[model samples]
Target: MRFTWAQRLTIAAAIAVAPMSAAHAWNESGHRIVARIAWDELTRPQQVFASELLVRHPRFAEDFAARMPPDIAARAADDPERQRWVFMHAAIWPDLLKAEGKRLSERIAALPAGAEKTELERRLADVKRYDNATWHYDNKPILIDPYALPPAAPPGAKPIGVQQALPNALRELDDRNLPAERRAVALAWVLHLLGDSHQPLHAVSLFSARHLPQGDLGGNVFFVVKPRPADPTPVRLHAVWDDMLGTDPKLEAATKRQIVAAFPRSRLKQELAEPADPPAVEAMVNLWLDESYRAADTSVYDANLRAALLAPLPAGATSALPVALDRRYLPAALPVARRRAALAGYRLADCIRRAESRSRP
Candidate 1:
């Protein structure tokens, strides 16, 4: 039986709400690039519709408008430009929630049992419940050894992985019966997770007999040194991929424009040529995950770099030693990362279009 996008999305969402922890995929700049690309592709009417929905977000006033940079906030603009600004920033809302949730956790822990503490506790619960940081990646461990298979989840364990989360967000986005505020939050997650799913590191975890028996937590546990001389210190493998596009938060606007200009138009044209039907969309997501898994195994975890950087594992060691990426690794991986980002944008736009079409009267 063929499953409609709505049905698959429903199942995915139901599975994801069970609580599983994972890392965020692309950094803010990378997510912004995907958002900007998708935004540029959307029709004016579609953009307006999306912006209207976003404004319905419960915290839009405080989190978006009031928190806008002084210059933009002073203008008090509510035109399409202002709407687009809000829409683009929505892509990063999950990340923002993570920061807010952390501080809230600290505050809640410090507060005594009083009215103020009770109120803070309630808000903290909401933030934790809605925080999508863990929803960004699937921790399905990819065993490096070709002969070995990945470990199965324990019979009773329910880990809501990224593969499950994307469809859940999509289902939420398409549920017109739901409040616009709820749908808007889902839309933000859809945008963010689409970008996350395309990042190779986010889709797969490395497993080896000597090191990662369970998994590397999608490279979170696998530290790697930056190739740059100035920043030789070890960083998470996942973080390096997250910042592949660029790291400066202030540079998002310019970087968005630069990426748009530099994006291979032919490739983008090829990807957008045909949108996947509802039944096929989940398969498309799975396909993207598989492709990313292959990349992580072949390129990101190439043997040469592993040999150069990783120290010899001690007998009975449970983890691989942190390793430095070769100078050539970054240069080699950058193009692949850029291509994936561009493809994510095109695919996201397609998903948005499909959802809009299905929701139409």
Candidate 2:
């Protein structure tokens, strides 16, 4: 059965509000798509090496294998295929860790200060150590006004943006000197963050003098509602884009196959032609971020969409209120969202191949 845009949006928004929390970039389906694409492109040895590392993930058995879907569990051909599935789920591990951390903190708060509380606090610290949540998105502020320059960081302040984080993860994946366990963790993050960086919202934040002088926190605070008669509860603009790919794993897998097939063959061939050296890889990542920033500037922060979604502040009106998305907004943005997901998958494959090449003797 076919679903209209409105129906899809309703289902997506409902899912967003339910038990599943929104992720930093493309949601679970999007990340899984990227991982699946990369996995498909990997050579046999590369695949085996990646799986071996992933099998060593500290929580692979408890947090990954145990949570595998019944369908996937039943159909695995062998250990290698199951390992690949585990690696794909690992793409969402950081977000899951966030949720787990929150739950642990709540439990700790409910208990009195005792040995249990102390142990819980220690566990929380352990979770936080691996959290590195900010690594998912660069959040480099972009001024909406063409004439304005990006804000400079204050003296002595250090920011480990996604651009840095992703390359760092790649380095960790390539560094044989690091313990295999440590490298495995880095491999999982590399799988995830490469996908995150391709998401326009994760790469850039929109800044404007009239409404969002400090930036929209990567669209997280920009409230948007579906038209009246539909659910009017305001949702974050980022959340809307994040949910565009839907949440079903089977559907996502099918969509990944379709998107991969539909992607321009010439462009895909050019991207995968030769593994890039480190400097070239950095340049490629910067180029990708620039592309996303331009999309944020033009499409995501389009003046027409903004005007439709937000009412003018009355004379001396201080607070910006949520407004309905323009009828045309989603129709136009959906293709861009799909294109980004496809590009992310392609680039992730390129990166994994590069990492594998560098790791080989």
Candidate 3:
């Protein structure tokens, strides 16, 4: 059913980003770029404060230091380069928790009961507390069939999603009464989810009577194939958009410098949200989600792609054949993704500066 909110954002638009244990919102590289953009804009005081919070995070050694490159970890704790490296790590930390949790579970399952399994369980429990799949996308559903019944869930049993969690993360970070550790957890979430809010699919999902009765799970279920030279199996539509900027997992200094230079902050402008209260906080976050929804409606799902997705596959056909995008899709959609990532960085900076500029670690 149609959402009643002014921007039509319901509690949850599509399924969890990718079963909660996997983060498909943005590639690790993309999230790093977003974080770098914000780090560049922060004043020295803010940078120190932000970096201090990351240090206070409960998993600092396990999640941050252990995974950090030796060259970076060798720098002084407050070294600007080291801080920049951690900022990128913090932005994708939530996703890392999920990946680690999944790995822990697999290792535990494979091992016979022993000390190793017990330790893994403990780690998994810690990871589980932070691995929330829905936090990645607070989607607003869009109807593919104009007359289809509106999505079923609503006021009844609300879906836990970024729509609610993101604001809470802000409030947690801003609440000086809380311990630094709690705020540190909030810091990682803010870094990751702000970029997620800008992803078009994370903001909107398609619903239809026959084809997508339960929504496209924010494009996770919507498959398409790119024109590859060889074997090209259908890939999740969500994935194609996630890697629009670039997919190399490494966050090299040179590449980071290149992306920050390429996007150049010119086409990105979003209202900076300085949330004063809970409701106000929601409104602020919704502004980003709404902008993303507009992009998804106006651009990503062109008429041809929509037609194929809104109808069921013919007898035994596949999305590879029917939903293949024309070569123009990437060239056209890439800029939109890039601009949004850049804007996410800008908003993330504005968000931190407005929310924590006055607070001291």
Candidate 4:
């Protein structure tokens, strides 16, 4: 069946499972896909770095440790902080878990008919390297949406872009360089920041119901909906979005499948073909930022931004801003997170592919 432009847009947006919170959390499925892609293209050292960075699941983390060089493991083990860091890194990113499943299978496939654990361990470790030299902290402001109009300040207030905090963090990274061994850890920090920056609650400000009562501390102090359905209790709004970040992938996937099944093949094809490169990740980041800006630009989202804004807001709550707030148009934001994850994974793979291919010749 053919869908109208509005229908198609709505369908695509709905695939994402919006209405969810925007707090930062690890996205495992996304992490897995990315690791799988990166593992397929990257050599040993690169795979190790990428694998460690991707956090699809707990088993994958164990697999990573199992595959690491004994010497590197000993060094990591000796340093409790380093060992803990690796484990924490795995806990945060979901893609690594996804890749672990495939990473093990690939190894098993390459072995001789009766290859033993010793040979497998040797091959895996031979490819994995513990190089701290390759990573660096980039403090440069990676602008989410350079194109969006800057947010206006209230009568006497100063104007600030929603991307404020995370960009500042990134900028700091670019200001200093790290020695090679420490580079991987540095990358992890920036990666976390980038992910955090994309969350709308983290990106925007909130305030009281009326009379400009009080400012919400980036949603930290503002009381929004409570986590429980039966209670009218309140909690910080920021936490809501953060929790939504990784709430349920099975539900997210089910929603996406339903939406895509109805999606127009032509348009879906076009979207898939439009751009899938590293720059695309940058662009999508910008797009999400722009959408946030648009939502916050006026008292509310313009018709263009209305969909994104209303999609996530509580039902029946009117926007303080001028933009229309239609309850019927709410779209789930999970799909957006999923796509972002995929793009991040693909972009990471692309980066590693270029590096690995260069080493080949």
* Candidate that scores best on lDDT: 3
**How does residue 354 of candidate 3 score in lDDT?**
63
Clashing pairs in 2: none
Score every model by TM-score: 0.84, 0.83, 0.85, 0.40
Better of 1 and 2 by lDDT: 1
Kindly indicate the candidate among 1 and 4 with the higher lDDT.
1
* lDDT tens readout by residue for model 2, 1-361: 1224564455445434542112378888888887887788777887877777787887776567779888767865446668678878888888888888999999998999999999999988888878876777777677655544545657995657788888788788878788888888898888888888878888776666655555566777666776556566667788887887777877977887776776744555654354444355467678778778777877877676555325556565344435467678787787777777777776776666766777777
Model 2 residue 169 CA deviation (Å) reads: 0.5
Whole-model alpha-carbon lDDT for candidate 3: 0.76
Off by over 4 Å in 2: 1-23, 70-80, 145-156, 227-230, 264-280, 306-320
| Maximum-TM-score candidate | 3
Which prediction has more favorable lDDT, 1 or 3?
3
Expressed as tens digits, the lDDT of each residue in 132-249 for candidate 4 is 1111111111112323232343587433332343343233323334333233433443444344444444445443333112333344443333322324333344444455434564
lDDT per residue, candidate 3, 268-350, as tens digits? 43244333452477887888899889888877787768776556565544222225776677778987887788788887887
Query: Number of clashing residue pairs in every model?
Result: 0, 0, 2, 39
In the range 272-335, model 1's lDDT, one tens digit per residue, is: 4664444555676787788788888788887865553245655554334445576788888887
Candidate 4, lDDT over the whole model: 0.38
Cα deviation of 131, candidate 1, in Å: 2.0
The positional error of residue 257 in candidate 2, measured at the CA in angstroms, is 2.1
- Which parts of model 1 have CA positions greater than 4 angstroms off? 1-22, 146-152, 275-278, 306-320, 358-361
Q: What overall lDDT goes with each candidate model?
A: 0.73, 0.73, 0.76, 0.38
